[model samples]
Target: MLESLKVLDELRLNFSQSGLFILNLTLAFIMFGVALEIKFEHFKKVILNPVSTLVGVFSQFFLLPLITFLIAILLRHYITPTIALGMILVASCPGGNISNFMSSLARGNVALSVSLTAIATLSAIFMTPLNFSLWGGLFTEIYSRTDASGLVRPLEIDVGQMFQTVFILLGIPLVLGMWFNHRFPDLTKKIVVPIKRLSIVFFMGMVVMAFMNNFDYFKAHIKYIFLLVFIHNAVALTTGYSIASLFRRNATDRKTISIETGIQNSGLGLVLLFNPKIFPPDLAIGGMAFITAWWGIWHILSGLGIAGLWGRKRKRVVTIQ
Candidate 1:
């Protein structure tokens, strides 16, 4: 297992130029679909109740990365620096494209979910690059402390370039989608369901294409990476729920924050990993690549499971009451 994971440092997932382009377009459309669920009322509620929104954002952008840092430190000897950085990069990302839907499915605060998603997505433009650089840089420090060679590459994120990329991918599309939603509510209603379904399909197809491009590695190593991702994801969900609970937010709010924090935008991470300006294949950030790909698939399963249980539990509680 150790050898398999160590090999990831050298094995790069080859993402073709056309594949990268399709991935970017697919992710942007997903972000646009997420925006369709947003409205002024969502932000208005967040502004009024601010506590839940603040807690969710804090858990996502701040606490999630911090906890991931500590987890990396704890597992320093067990995992490669590249894999640890992959975990950090995912933690630094905003809530996933499906978080709002999960929130609603769980009988949580849909408004807070949308509000947090909007704010977190916008914030990720800056926070994602900053947090990844900041925390990922720390991994080098930890490794350098023990290794005389100090060959582990610290992830260097260019904030200026990232800002431009994020704005074009997430910010602009979001603003346009929100504007369209505002301008034509009926039209938004007509297409929102189909768009959301298609976005999900697009992403699933992206994952399949990436695997087809690197079938041998993905098939061989997926099992090795599963538990690491599960633990990391668990930390995120727990951190959000714990913080929200500490603040005495109700069950619905707790569920919203938990799901939001746990389900990160790994699609964005994959995008960066594939970008020539970023990690790219030759850099052999394979640990990052594998983790990102698996996380994308695993979190969907975990989120839907949790949402299903919560949805059922809520129904039971309502019946009892």
Candidate 2:
């Protein structure tokens, strides 16, 4: 499998410059929609009730990436370098915007979910790059010594460029949307739902475009990608829940943290991967692209599935009472 997957290092996805622009815009728009739901009150909630929020943040930005690196190391012989790095990148991303919806559906703490999302996004401008660089660099360094195949390239990422890209993509829109929401409360309320719904639609369209453009590559390698993502995502969800439980959090908080940690901002990962400045076009990081792209679709399915099960379980408990 590792030998077969080596071909992914040389495979390039069919994304053009214009498509990259659209993807960036779509991600920005989604972030803006996410900001509409955030307010000063959410931050205040964090200040007053910091335990769960901090746990969620720690679980996501700290533990997830570390766990992913360990998983990559354990499965080193079973996976390629790009695939391992792809998992690291996704783990390094912030929680997904859709997690709030899934949390609500699962009868979890929606306020905590939103708070975690806002905090994670803000922190991601720094944490994403830091975690990815730290873990990715370490992974390559460790494996390069043992594997003489010359496949492991040094993780040569421009931290300054990444910081700039993350700020422009996430920071600016987040500030603007939050400001707009603060200034016009009534309008924000009226438009937030539609914008959130539309953002999800646009993001799904972006995923569809990615699949359409690289259908053949995805078709050939999706089996391996699927299994890797499945295990990785399950670990993420478990990490969140286990951390929350270890901290003695309530059931709702456990659910919220689990969902938040499980559903990563793979859309952001896609944008970063496609950015020529961050990752040049000539670099054959197709495995990274495939993992990031498939992750965007799979997490949604997994999140919703888990949320549905939790919802049904809650309803059954309520009936018994």
Best by TM-score: 2
RMSD of 1: 1.4
Model 1 clashing residue pairs (backbone):
none
Off by over 4 Å in 1: none
lDDT value, residue 111 of candidate 2: 98
Instruction: Give the Å shift of residue 7 in candidate 1.
Output: 1.8
Question: Which lDDT tens digits does candidate 2 get at residues 1-321?
Answer: 777677776787657889888999999999999999888899999999999999999999999999999999999888888999999999999999799999999999999999998999999999999999999999998888777764544677687888888989899989999999999999999999899899889989888876686687778878888999999999999999999999999999999999999999999998888888888777778888888888988999999999999999999999999
At residue 211, candidate 1 shows an lDDT of: 67
User: What TM-score against the true fold does each predicted structure earn?
Assistant: 0.96, 0.97
1-321, model 1: which lDDT tens digit per residue?
767888777876766788788988999999999899888788788778899999999999999999999998888778887888899989988999988889889999888899999899889888988898788887778777876656444655556777677778889888988999999999999999999889878888877876675678777887779999999998888899999999999999999999999999898888877787766345768788789888998999999999889999999999999
- The lDDT for every candidate, in the order shown, is 0.86, 0.90
Query: Residue 248 CA error for candidate 1 (Å)?
Result: 0.4
C-alpha RMSD for every candidate: 1.4, 1.2
